[model samples]
Target chain A: MTPILIALTIGIPWLGAIIVWLMGDRREDLTHWVSILFSIGAAITSVLLLPNASQETALTIPIGGDFGDFTFVADGLGIFLSVIAAVIGSLAVIFSKSYMKGEGSLGRYYAFVLFFIGAMVGLVLSSNLLLIFLFWEITALCSYALISFHNDDPKAVKGGIKALIITSIGGVGLMVGALIVYAYTGSYDINNFLANYSTIPGNILALLAFGFLIAAAAKSAQFPFQTWLPDAMEAPSPISALIHAATMVNAGVYLLARFYPAFKDVPYWSEAVMIVGALSALLAAVMALVSNDLKRVLAYSTVSQLGYMVYAIGTGSVYASQFHLFSHSIFKALLFLSAGAVIHSIGTRNMLEMGGVGKKHPLVKWVFIIGALALAGLPILNGFWSKELILESGLKNGPLWLYIVMVFVAGLTALYTIRCVWLVFFGEPRSDYHAHAIGWEMIAALLPLAGAALVSWLAAGRFSVLLGEKSLPFHAIEPLPYKEMMHEILSLPTLVVMAVITAAILLWVFRKKLEGLINGLKSIRWAAENSFGFEAINNAIVKVTQSTAEALRVTQTGILNWNVFGILASVILLLAILVLGA
Target chain B: MNLPIPLVVLITILCLAGIGLYCLLITRNLIKVVIALQLIVKGAVLAFILAGNMTGQLNLAQSMALTVIVADTIVAVVGLALAVQIRLKTGSLDIKSLSSLKR
Candidate 1:
């Protein structure tokens, strides 16, 4: 039954692709309904399985006979993420109807989207390293296809290729780690590795830990490999909400959480993970602050948020990481889908062209405001509780200095969240360019996400238990009347920090009057815009690889008879050796 | 006891494999690559037959070899078709000219 269900997780979406293809491009109404039903069905299955998944029962299937088996434990970690993926994926599909209308190749688009949803489910559920890698690559494939869905545009094509190349590098790291584990343990099962990791040599285990680190960093868009994700904004908005913001990027954090038990003992691994997470969060926050493109800003914000999750895992707060993963998924999805609604109506992703949009699209305004408040970790929102939990975990479990850095990041997160909202919704109206009208599909998608963004934190206890047996130790601030639930988010220090940061950003946003006294860091701005010149470095590497391949191809003479003779000689030598041995 | 004809055929097969690898390394022409692949397949078939003779495994080696031959034929057929298409598109079979997939 477990094997059948596991197979269904991956197989169902791919099968849906077939049904979608059969429906044809002429019938989009049929296509949208099919996609909605398929994804919702997948989400329900994932939810039903969550309660059964806890610490006790894990599902397993032996694949490829004697090689290894695919194992999935519905443990705290996997089910939490599976729920996020399925739920967000269904919402994003529902949202796409208005966003995708009048767009070409609707059939192909939905097929790939549904296919990616299934792949993400498979990726999180797989406890076999090899199977995880397979699903990982498949998601990369889907991402590439979706990002480049508008094949006629060169920029979209370029974005897709860049995403493919960068993520494939992560795939290599994951494969290498898997092979290292297999070399030591004689099996590809993750549970077996986790169970017996202590028996492996320390140096070998450390290498495996570092290998997985590189894999996680690349997939989650930590520091160096993060440039690809912002560029991936060329994908349609619904795809961005589903793939980039909510689901696919979390694969790296999931991996780190999964292996933390084994790697926590290795020297410098957790430290390295924390440092990477901190730097990425801080750097991406700065990037988001400077970005004028609406989608690109959100893209950078996703990277920054992922950095916090990575840092939480590094700090040994597995619950903090998973909880943030849960909250980030809903709020970020809400934000992206709301942004999608705005972009769909305005037909522009540039914030420079958008202002006073909220007055006209009042529903969109309220929905987006809810998403933005949650993103800023404002009081009474789901993000406030989760981000506070993470920050508290960093203080208690992580180094003091690291907690300081995270607190600073929280302030920055608030500043930018306000900056984005103020610019898009509250500022003077920009020129009203041609735009698509908001539709029922858009409203249907955005409203529920906003609600989730508000209420999802109620599952905090359930999430903490799922992460491990240890109940989370959280400090509640008093004197607000409804102290246990609502007022717990606000206190003297939290309120002071929020008010101070919000004021600072307002000053910064309106700082033209104080421009003469402002810091003139032109070099920093230049560096951030150019991705710290990593583009040039990556291009150089691509050049060297291409040149090396060209140099090697000179040997392929392409002659028919000469090649025939070469093969003949090698076979004769091999046969002679075999016959002599016999 | 004398070795059978099959043993001699297998030895010849190894000689062909050696030649094929050499050609694959040394040749520059596109058509040569295709022919070398065929030689490798043929050598593989000959080795299988020889193994059958030693183990008294009747028809197993022959059928497996036949399968390789079939695969080789299919590959060759595809190669030839691609070559024809390339010649029409580029007016030459030179791989250097046809390396459009390069960055």
Candidate 2:
């Protein structure tokens, strides 16, 4: 029965992809309905598996031979991530019905989206490392294809290629780690490797540990790889909500948390993960503070939120990280979709072009504010609880200095969230842009997420029980009861942070008198806008690859015989080497 | 172990393959390239037959050789047709002049 549920969760969306793709762009209405129905079906199936979440393996299919067994585990971690992917994926699809109403190539859009959701589900549920890698690449492919869905635009095409190349570098890290595990254990089973990884030598284990760190950093858009995600805003708004905000980026944090127990004791590994997360959170928050583009701000915020999760894992708190992942997924998806609603209506993504939009679209205004309040870690919202938990874990288990830096980053997060809300909704109209009315489809999607942002933290006890205490063995902190946790979160330091946020907002409101002081910070703003030259370095790497490819193009003379000659020569050379070696 | 017949046949096939490769690399006319490709196929066929005879699988080799012949003939016919089309379109059959297709 568990296996059947897993199959339905993965297979239904894939089947929907094929069916909608065949329906073609001419039948846009049918394609939209079919995609929504199938995605919701997957969502329901994943929810049905929640009660069965445990340490035991749910199902296995023996492929025989060297490939090893394909297994699926309904463990707490796997089932939780699958539920996030399926549920948020369904909401994104429903929002797209109105968001992508008149867009051509509707079939292609729906197909790539459905395929991506299925791949994400398969990725989380699979217990085999090789099978996980396969699904990982599939998600990357779907992201690339969907990012470039508007292929007529050169920027969209460039964004897609950049995303593909950067993420593929991470893919190599994961592949190498998988191969090393296979070499040492003679199997691709993740549970088998995790149970016996210590028997492998120390140096190889270190290599695997750091290799996976690089993989997670690259995939999650931490540090140097963080630049591509902001550019990924060239994709449509719904795709941004679905892939960039809700699911794909979270996979990296998921990978780190999943392997934390095995790699925690590797010397300096935890500290390095902490530094990466801390730096990403700080840098992205700074960048978000300066961005004028609406979606780009959310994109940077997603990177920062993911950094917090990674930092939680680094602090030896898997429960903190996974719980944060849960809260962040709901609120971020809500924020992005609300931003989508605004963008869809105003026909622009520039915040400077939008002002007092709240007065025009009151529903969108309120929903965006709910998401912002949650994002700012205000009291009683979901982000506040999970974030305070991460801070508590960090202080207790990790370095003191890094925990302080993260708290400062949380303030920065609040500052940006307030700035974003004020710029878009509070000030007088800044540009002459007529806004469209919010549709029922968009409203239906945003309401549930807004509700979740307010109440999902109430499930903290259940989340802890689901993710058993033994999940993090090395630095396992005792789970706090809900009432006590809430009391601690509303203490003195929380009041101080809230007060600081309010003061910052008031200062921004009266900034006309502080023009001189604002001018003094021009250099910092310039650095923030440039992403501190990280984008330049990433661009250089891409340029080098393109030039190298261009130089190699000379080998293809386009004469058929030349190509055949090249192939035959290579074949002969390989044969001679084999014969000589034998 | 001194199997002279098989050894000589193997050497002959290798020589044919070498000559065909040389023509493929150095030839200027498109038609000569097609003939060189056929030479390579013929060498492979001869080697298969020799291996089959030595290993007592003559009937299998013969059937494989017949299939190869049919495939090679079809390829040759298509290659000639494409070459003729190129000649008519561009008024030249020199392989070097086909650099127009290069980026």
Candidate 3:
């Protein structure tokens, strides 16, 4: 029964993808309804699968060959992530009903959305490293397809290709790690490897650890790989909410947390992860603070928040990371969707042109504020609880430098959230832009997430229990009771983060008087806008690849005989190797 | 000198593959290229059968060889159909325009 539910959780959306795509773009209403129903069905099945979670693998399909057994475990981490992917994916599809009402190629949009949800669930559930890689690539492909759904737009196509290329590079890292695991263990089962990884020699293990780190960083848009995500804003807002903010980006954090027990003792691994998280958090916060583009700022903040999760994992606080992942998914989805609502109505994503939007759409304003307050980590919000948990954990276990950077990023988070809100919704109208009526579907999607942003922290006790050591024997996670969790958070580190955040708010309130300080930070602001030179590095690599490809074009004469000769030559070389020893 | 059965079969396989490669290197017509591919695949199919006979898995080897032939036949058919289309469109059997991926 559990295996059947697991199958349904993944299969339902994939089945929906095929059906909806087959339905085509003729009836937009039917397409939207089918997507919502299928996604919701997946959501329900995934949620049902959660209670049956255990240490044992839920299902195994044995092919009895080199590809090995495809195993899926409905453990705490896998179940929760699948739940997040399905639930938030359903909401995004609901939001899209209003957002993508008359967009051409409705089939393409919803098909990719459903496919991505299924792939994400599959990615988390699968314990076989090779199968996980397959699912991982599937998600990346769906993300690329959906990102370029507006294929006629050159910018969207370019952004999609950029995302695909970067994530595929990360996919290479994941493949390398999987291959190494297979090579050493002679099997691809993650649980088996986790128990026996110590038998593998030290350097090979380090290589695998760092390789997985590279995979996680690129997928999560951490540090150097953060540039593609802001450009990925060319995608639809619900896509931004579903793939970027909510589910797919969280895969990276999920990877780190799942493997934390195995990679725990690798020399300098935790420090490296911590530094990557701190750098991403700090850098992205600064970028968010200066961004005029509404969605770009949110994109930057998403990176910043993911950094906190990565930082938590670096601190060996798997529970905090997963908890923060939960909280971040809810509020960030709400934020992106509300931002979508604003963009949908105003017909612009530039915050500079979006002042006084709140007055026209009070519902969007209130919901965005709820999400923003959560993003800003205000008291009584889910973000605050989870973020403080992360911060407290980081302080106790992580290095002083990284702890300090994370705390600073927390303040920076509040400052940018306030600034973004003020720029888009407060003050007098900044530009002469006509606003449209907010859709009922948009409101329906926004309300639940807004409510979740407020109260998701209430599930902290249950969440910890779900991820506890009982279910995940390798990960030493202790369940946190609600009152004690609250008590634990009411400590010096929390006070320090609160003070830093208050100072950030005050800085925003008195911006006019801080002209000197602002001017002093101009260099940093310039660097932030330029993505601190990672964009330049990405461009440099692209330039080299293009030039190299151009230089090698002579080899591709395209004549049939020449191509056949080339293939024959390679075959001959292989034959030579086989005939004569080396 | 009398060769072992495996050695004789191996030499036959090499001769067939070598002829195919030579034809492929010189062929300008798409149909000739398709024929060359078929010859190469026939050699591969023979090699598989020989390998199966040696390994005492004649059934598995023959099944695999049959699968390869089926797929190779489809390829030949597609290649010929494409050649016919190209001939009709361009008024020649030139493979250059069809093969080159360069834009």
Candidate 4:
């Protein structure tokens, strides 16, 4: 039963991708419905596997080589992420049906989206590093294709290429780490590595530990690699909701938590992770505060939220990290989909052009508010409970200074969230832009996520049990019940919440004064707007690669004889070197 | 049977490969380039046959040589066709003029 469930979770979306691709854009309606059905099927299978989350290696195929066994574990961590991928993926597909209505190349859009779902599920479930890397690359390819789904737009195409190149660099990190492990253990099985990682020499183990950290940071858009994700907003909003917000970005923190036991002892490793997370959270929050583009703001917030999870892992709180990941996946998806509805209606992503939109589209307005409240960590929402847990764990187990910085970041999160809500939904009409009526399909897609954001923290007790009792190296004490969790969160002097509220109210009341202050800090705003010169650095790297390729093009010659001469000379040189070595 | 056949074959293979590569690098005419390419293929075939003979796999070497000949013939035919097309289009077979195909 478990094997079949795992197969269905992965295989359904894959099969759906092919079927939807064949259906083509001529029957866009059919293609959309097929994608939704397949995504839901995958989601259902993942839910079915939840009860069996205690089972390790629920299914295995003996591939019989250095590749090791192809295995899937229905463990708590894997199953939890799989469910998020599939369920949120289904909602995104449903939302896309409306958001992408009458769009060209519907077949291609749905195909890549469904394929990404399967790849993400496979990525989380696989217990073999080789298979994980394969699935990882597949997700990257899917993201590239989907981000450039608007292929006619030059910006979209450039964004897609940048995403592919940067993520592939990270993929190389993961591949190198996997190969190093295989070199030492002669197996690619993750279970094998996890069980006896310390038996490997300390220096080599440290190298592997940092290599995996690089991979996670790159994948999750932590720090220096984060500029790619905000640019990835060029993708359709539904794709943003599904891949960037809910599933794919979480893979980085998931990687850290999944391998925490092996890497926890590596000197300065946890500190490095904490620093990466803290910097990303703070920087992305400031970027979010300054950005006028709605989706870009949300994209930056997603990075900030992911940083908290990474910070949780760094603080030796895998359960806190995973729990926050759950809450974030729910609310962020809701926010993105609601933002999608708004963008689809107004046909622009700029928040300055979007005032009084809530008056026109009340349903979207309310749902967006719900998402914002959850994101800002207001009490009684899932984000509040999970975020408090992360901060609590950080304070208790990690550095006090880092914990203090994260709390300040929480205030920044609230300031940006409310600012986003006000500029888009509440302010005086800043422009004459008209909004389309909120569609039922978009509202339907948002409803479940909103409910989850409101009530999902009730599952904290069960989740704690699953993490503590079943998964090794993740022995979180059983979490407090919902009532006690709320009391605990409310009883922490409420300093962060108070700061957030005060900052939000002051920003709202003194808009003119703050505008002057914001203008006074022109240099800081300029730096934030340009992602603090990281974009320039990345662009220089790209330019160098292009120029190097141009230099190499001198050898192409277009003359057949010269080309053959080049190949023959290289072959002869290699042979000579081999002979000399022998 | 006791002659230095292996050494003689090795020297011949080296000379053929060197000559082939020199022609390829120095040739101006597309047809001469094609001939040079074939000469390199012939050297490779000779080396394969010599190695197989030394290992007592004469039959296998002969069969491989035959396969190489067939493949080379097909390649030569296609190359000449492409050369013809290039000549007809450009009114010259000078390899330098063919550089127009470069992006």
Candidate 5:
């Protein structure tokens, strides 16, 4: 049952992709409904896969050679992430019914969206490293295609290419690690590698561990690789909510958490992961605070929240990281969708033009506030509990200085969330832009996520059990009941973190009196606006790659004679070598 | 002038391949290129059989040759079809005219 359901979870979305593409733009309404229904079906299939989660491989195809068997395991981690991908994917598709209405190429948009959903599911479920890499690349491709969905817009195209190039570097890292593991063990089974990694020589093992770290950092947009995600805001809002916020970016944190038990003891690995997460959370929050574009602010916040998850994994608590992941997915998707609704109505993404929006779109205002509260990590919200859990674990296990840095970032999170919410939804109208009505489809998507953000912390009990020892044998996390989990969160450090967050919120309320401090901090603001010079570095890298490709282009004559002669020459070269060696 | 069967076959393979390569170097017609490709593939097929005979794996070699023939036919058919379309569109059989590299 689990195996068939796994097949359905991955297969259903791909089938929908093909169906939606074939449906064409002739009947755009039917295309919308077909995509929504197909995505909802996949969501249901993956959710059904949850209760039957086990350590056993749900399905395996015997490829029987150097690559080993193609395997899928319905483990706790895999099932939960798939459930997130499928569920949030369907919501994005439904929201697009209104968000993307009258938009050209609806068929192309829906096809790539569905394709990404299936690939995300496959990436998590597959235990074979090579299969995981393939799915990873497919998701990256879908992300690139969707990011530049408005292909004529040069900024959108540039954003898409940047995302593609950065993420492909990540793909190379993962492929190298997988190939190395295969070279040593002669199999691509992840479970086998995890179980017997010690057999590999220390130097090579360290190489694999660090290689995967680079892969995760690039994919998750951590530290130096964090620039592409903000540019990914060029995507349509539903795509941003589903791919950039809820699903795709989490793949990085998920990779780290999934392999925690294997690489935890590697010298300096956990510390490196900690510093990456800490730096990302700090830099992104500052950037989020300063951004004027509504979507870019949300993009930065998403990076910050992902940093918290990675930090939890670095502290050796996969459960805390995943719990935060679950919480973050709900709230961040809510925030982005509500932001989408606001943008879709205003026909502009500049927050300076969007003041007093709450007066017209009251439901959107309330829902946005709910998401904001979750983002700010205020009491009674899922983000509050999970974030405190991470901090608690970090203080106990991670270094003191990094914990202090993470706590400071939590306050910055509050400051930015409040600043973003106020700038877009509150104060007097900054401009005389006409506002359109919020669509029921947008409301339909926003309400469920808002409710989830409020109450998801109550599931702490079941979440732990699902990700506990039986499924993930290496990362032997134990189950914590709801009461105990709450008790664990309600500690002295939690109060301290809450105080920091409250102080940040209050600091915003009294910003008029802090002119001197604001002026003093102008340099920090300037740095944040400039992306702390990472954009310059990335642009230089892009220039280098383009020049290198241009230099190599002269060799491709495209004449058949030239190609054939080249092939002949290579063949002769090989024959000469063989004969000389003989 | 008596030659071993393997040596005779090897020389035949070389002659066939050399003619194909020489034609490919000079011809601009897409149809001739397809024909040249078939000649090269035929040489490859004979070489496979020759290797099989020496290695005593004639059956496997024959099966591989058959598979190559089926695939080679499709390549020829597609190439010729593309040539016909190119001719209709551009009114030239010269592959140089089809070069997208230059204006």
Candidate 6:
């Protein structure tokens, strides 16, 4: 049953891709229906499979002799992520129906989205390291294709290429770590590696651990690799929502959480993870505050939110990390889709061109506000509970200094969230762009997510149990009366933190009078806008890698026959060494 | 005390690899590079066959060799296609001409 569900989890979208592709460029309705139904099926199966999965329920299919197994697991962690990928994926597809109506190449759009969904599911479900790498690369490919979906736009193509190049560097980390594990354990089975990894040398273990860290950082857009994501806003807003909120970027956090049990005990790994997350969170938040492009602002916000999840993992709050993942996916998707509706109506992502839109488009206004409130960690919203849990865990388990920094970062999050909302929706219309109302499909996509953002905190206990952290004895430091079971979030400290976050929001809202003081600290503003010069450093590394690849490309010698000969000769030489005396 | 046919095959494979390496090192033409790559693949397949003969593990070697064949074939196909594209687009096959990547 588990294998069947796992297969459905991955296969449904793949099958949908084939069907959508088969329908070709002509049949839009059939393609849309096929994609929608298949995505829904995938989501339902993920939800149903969650209850059956233990920590060790894996399905392995024999690939061939000696090449080892292609495996999938329905673990609590994997199943939880599958639910996010499938659920948010289906909503995006539904939203895309109205958003993509009459746009060029509906068939191709649905095909790639389904392909990406399948790849994401495969990534989370795979229990073989080799298989995981295979799925990981596939998601990168799909992301590239989808981001470049409007292929005529040079900026879109460039954005897609940047995503491909940067994420592939992360892929190198995954592949190297997998190969090292296989070299040590003599099996590609992930469970085998997890069980026997400690028997390997400490230095080698550290190397593997760092390799995965690089992979996660690059994939999740931590610090140096973070620039690619904001540029990726050139993709359609729905794809941005999917990649940023639900699918691609989440792969990084998933990798960290999945392997935390093994690498948690390794010295330096947790600290490095924590520093990377904190720096990214703080840096990206400031960038988000200053960005004028609405989608780019949200893109930076996504990076910042991912940093919070990464920071949670670093502080040993795996449950808090994953719980935030669930909440963040809902609100962020809601935010992106609402932003999409606005962009679609006004034909601009520039917030300066988008003032007073809320007064006209009540649906988008309300939904965007819900998303913003949740993002700001206001009371009764899901983000508040999970984010506070992470901060609490940091205070208890992480250093006090780091906890204080995160708390301040939370305030920055609230400030930017309010600032973004005010710039887009409130005040008078600032530019010539005409504001229009949203359609029913747009409303349909957004309303449920707003509800989810409001209510997902109800599942915090289940999250704690799934992450294996519920047994830890700890104090509930909140003063408000939170329910011990379902409504377990209302506490005094939470209310105080909320008060601080709200205060930050009020300060940013009134910054015009404070402009003199802000200008006095212009260097800090400049560093934040430029990502503290990290962007320049990252660009240098990419440039070096490109030149090196070009230099290596010189070896390819344009002749096809030589390539064949080189392959044959290398094969022969290796055989000679194995079969004959030295 | 036996000199097997496969042992002779193994030595021939090494000789071919050495020749391929010499060609790869000395040649300036991209075409020659492909020929060298093909030679390497041949050497690899020959080695796999020899190993299978020695260990009596025919299936494993064949499967692994099949993957090698797939990779080599892909390189050959894509490399030729790209070469033609570059030649048509830039009107040359010279590796120096490809250096326009610097821009």
Instruction: Please tell me which predicted candidate would have the highest DockQ against the true structure.
Output: 3
Instruction: Write out the backbone clash pairs for model 2.
Output: none
- Model 5: number of clashes? 0
lDDT of 2 by residue, A17-136 (tens): 998899888778888999999999999999998887766667888998998889888777788889999999999999999999989999989999999999999999998989999999
| Candidate 6: RMSD to truth | 6.4
Of the native A-B interface contacts, what share survives in model 4? 0.74
Evaluate residue A482 in candidate 2 and report its C-alpha lDDT on the 0 to 100 scale: 86
lDDT of 5 by residue, A64-162 (tens): 766788999999999999999999999999999999999999999999999999999999999999999999999999999999999999999999999
lDDT of 6 by residue, A1-582 (tens): 888899988999999998888887677777777888998998899888877766554687888976588877777677788888888999898898888877878888888898888889889888888989999999999888988999999999989998998899899999999999889999888777777778989889899888999999889989768988988898888898887766789899988887776788789899999888998898899899888899988998899989999999999877778888889999999999999999999998888877898888887888899999888888778988888888777877888888777888889899888888998999999887865656677788898898899888877666655545211122111222235522334555566677789789779868988988888989888887787787788778879988999989868665544665687679889989888965
Global lDDT scores for all candidate models? 0.81, 0.88, 0.92, 0.89, 0.92, 0.83
DockQ, computed on Cα atoms, for candidate 6: 0.10
Q: How close to the true structure is residue A209 of candidate 4, measured as C-alpha lDDT?
A: 90
In terms of DockQ, which candidate is stronger, 4 or 5? 4
Candidate 2 C-alpha lDDT tens digits along B25-98: 87878899899989999999998899889899999999999999999999999999989998998888888777
Native A-B interface contacts kept, per candidate: 0.04, 0.48, 0.78, 0.74, 0.35, 0.00
- Number of clashing pairs per prediction, in order: 47, 0, 0, 0, 0, 50
Stretches off by above 4 angstroms in model 3 are A571-582, B1-20, B27-85, B94-103
Which residues of candidate 5, in runs, are more than 4 Å off? A63-66, A560-565, A575-582, B22-39, B63-100
Query: What CA root-mean-square deviation does each model show from the true structure?
Result: 5.0, 2.8, 2.7, 2.4, 2.6, 6.4
Residues A248-345 of candidate 4: C-alpha lDDT, one tens digit per residue? 98988988998898899999999999999999999999999999999999999999999999999999989889999999999999999999999999
Local error of candidate 5 at residue A504 (angstroms): 1.5
DockQ of 2: 0.49
Interface RMSD of each: 6.7, 2.3, 1.5, 1.7, 2.1, 6.2
Report the C-alpha lDDT of model 1 over A439-512, residue by residue, as the tens digit.
89888888888888888887776555555542111211121123343444455546655775677567757877
Q: Candidate 4 lDDT (Cα, whole model)?
A: 0.89
For model 4, how does the per-residue alpha-carbon lDDT over B2-92 read when each residue is reduced to its tens digit? 6598898998898888898899888888898788879889999999899899999999999999999999999999999999999999999
Q: What DockQ do the predictions score, one after another?
A: 0.18, 0.49, 0.63, 0.60, 0.44, 0.10
Proportion of true inter-chain contacts also present in candidate 5: 0.35
TM-score of chain B of each: 0.82, 0.90, 0.91, 0.90, 0.96, 0.82
